[model samples]
Target: MTPKLELRGVAKAFGEKGSPTRVTAVRDLSFTVAAGELVAVVGPSGCGKSTILNMVSGLYGPSEGAVLIDGAEVKGPRSEVGFMLQKDLLLPWRTVIENVEFGLETRKLPKAERRRIARAELRRIRLEEFADSYPYQLSGGMRQRVALARTLAISPELVLLDEPFSALDAQTKLVLQKSFSRTLSESGLSCLLITHDLQEAVIMSDRVVVLSGRPGTVVDTFAVDLPHRDDPLARSTLPATQAYVKRLFDTLHIAEGAA
Candidate 1:
């Protein structure tokens, strides 16, 4: 089967045409996200992690190579991809269910069908009680879970998550991390997570891909082979998790003393 997402020697540069001050964010970046696999890409600051997401989402075009979804070149945003960013961006006026229905609305789905899907997703996240509540009424972690439910409501072939849980408190972050990881695994959806947190990458991803600094390129990729991949807490204590986190830090050139 064709990979759900593929980037072959992809490079992205941002600048005005014919401008001398061009900035190359990514170079020779090639990787594939297989069906039902969650791949996490980790790198240091200014390493163009988010730029890779933009190219894959079709919000930005590659300067040198191709960004393909199921062997088809990405010309523009397609319905098969979902993007969940740091901000929940939930409409304050809209209720939790209403916010999730926004995409289904654009798809011209009937009101009943949209509400059914929206509530179903909310229930999956154990937020059914808040279906009638507005975004402002929810807690930060709750809002993020709502956002995840919204992203999954459409059932996209792949979801690109850009630090989706970075803003939460430590306790909330861990709770949501476990919940989201379990949900993604059970949903059987492909995902690409761009994050700066090494432990977060290992806990949430099936394979972790490390990138070099500045003009980011693939430096290393590791298949997380923990016995219990779905349980973040259970997996973290194992020696394999420690090894992967150490390797990731080493690859990012982070000194052991500083880390």
Candidate 2:
């Protein structure tokens, strides 16, 4: 089967044309995610992790190479790709249900059908109770759930998640990450998650792609081969899991001022 998403020789540079100060965010970055697979990208801070996400989302074009979604060249933003940034970015002025329905309105989906779909997504995230609540009234975790619900409302085949749980506390982050992982798995949606948490990447992704700093490039790739990675309890006790985590830390050397 053709891959759900593919990037070939993808590279990006910032600054002006003449005498340009080239900061190659991603160099010859190429990968493919099969339909229904989840992939995580981990790197240090300011390593151009978000830049790669932007390139994939078509928010910024590559200076070279091409991006393809389901065998078609990605010229502009496609409806099939759903992106969730670090911030929930919910419209405080709109209610939970209204925020979820915002995408449908832009897509010009009908009211009755949109409400039906949005309600289903909200229920999936267990946020149906907050359908009428405003974003400011909800906690950080709840607001994120709403954001995830909104991303799903559009029914995108590919989900691009950028540090979706970074801001929450340790407990809240773990809770939301588990919920997010379960929801993504149940939906069988292909995802590319950009995060600084190695453990989060290991627990949530089938494969982890590591990037270099400054002029970012794919430095290494590892498959999560732990048993019960999907189970929160099993993830911590497994020896193989701990080994992989150590290996990743060593490779990135985040503890040694690699970032």
Candidate 3:
């Protein structure tokens, strides 16, 4: 079966070709995320982790190779892909339900229908009581949960997460991680997550892909065999989980040292 997302020998470069100032961010990178599989990418800073997401989301075209979704080449922004960033990026003016409905609204969904969908998503995140609350009215973790509701309202086939929980406090981060992991697993959404946190990668993903430094390329990919994937808190405390984390750390260290 075709993978849900595929990056075939992908490379990205900035600045004009042959120009002295040109810089290649990632090169000869290849990976795949299968349907309903969550893949985490871990690498040192400046390894072009975010660059790869941009290419996959069609925000930027690859300088070489290709990005494909469901066997089709991605030439531009795709409706089947949803992206979430470190920041919530919620509209301050909109209420919780309204923020969740933003994407549906863009699709020209009828008001009642969009409202219904948004409400259901908010309920899923257990923020139904805050339907009328604005982003400023919620805590950091709540705001991110609202952001997640917004992302899922569209029912995208693939979700690209760029350090989505990196900003929260430690305790909040763990709670949100478990919640989000359960949500993703239940939704069966294919995900490609870019994160610096090795433990996060190990706990929340089916597999972890490590990249080398600048002009990033895949150095290694490890399958996570721990149980209770949806319950990240439980997974995090396991010796198996710590073992995976250590392996990821060593891989990253080696990659950085070689760079």
Candidate 4:
């Protein structure tokens, strides 16, 4: 089967060609996310982790090579891709359900149908009780849950997550990680997550891709063989999980502070 997503010899550069100020964010970066798999990317700051997601999401085009979804090139954003960031980014004026319904609204879905879909997503995340609450009324974790619900409401086949739980406290981050892992598994959605936390990568992903610093390129890839992938919290505590984390730390040279 074709991979859910593929980046072939992808490179992205900013500024005009041959210009002194030109910078390359990533180079010769290649990877794949298999269907129903979750892949996490970790690297030093400015390694273009988010740049890869933007290319996949079609927010920006790679200067060299190509991005393909299920064998076809991605020229621009498509309905089948969903993106979530570290911030909840919920509209303060909209209630929880209404916020979830925002994407559906943009698609011009019927109001009743939109409500039905949003409500179901809210229920899936176990936030149905807060459907009528505003963003300010919910805790940080709850708001992120709402953000997740909104991302899923459109039923995208693949979700690109950029540190979606980094803002939460340790306990809350674990809870949200478990929730997201379970949801992705049950829904059979493919995901590409960019995070700085190696532990988070090991606990949440089936495979972890490490990138080099600046002009990011694939340095190494590790397969996470922990049991119960859907329960990231449990996975995090396992000795095997720490082993993977340590391996990642080693690959990234976290202790050496290599630039």
Runs off by more than 4 Å, candidate 3: none
Error of 1 at 255 (Å): 11
Worst 10 residues of 2 by lDDT: 227-236
Arrange candidates, best lDDT first: 3, 4, 1, 2
Give model 4's TM-score versus the native structure. Answer: 0.97
Q: Which residue segments of model 2 deviate by more than 4 Å?
A: 254-259
Model 4 lDDT tens row, 112-136: 9999999999999999999999999
Arranged by TM-score, best first: 3, 4, 1, 2
RMSD (CA, Å), each prediction: 2.3, 1.9, 0.8, 1.5
lDDT of 2 by residue, 74-180 (tens): 87878889999889999999999999998889776678898999899899999899899999999999999999999988989999999999998899888888888
Residue 72 lDDT (model 2): 86
List, residue by residue over 1-259, the lDDT tens digit for candidate 1: 9999999999888997678998989899999999999999998878899999888899879999999999999999888899899999898999999998877777878889999999999999999999999999999999999999888888898999999989999999999888988898888899999999999999788899988887888888989877666778878888879888988988888422222
Full-model lDDT for every candidate: 0.89, 0.85, 0.94, 0.92
Best by the lDDT measure: 3
Where in model 1 is the C-alpha error above 4 Å?
254-259
Model 1, position 216, has a per-residue lDDT of 89
Q: What is residue 103's positional error in candidate 2, in angstroms?
A: 1.2
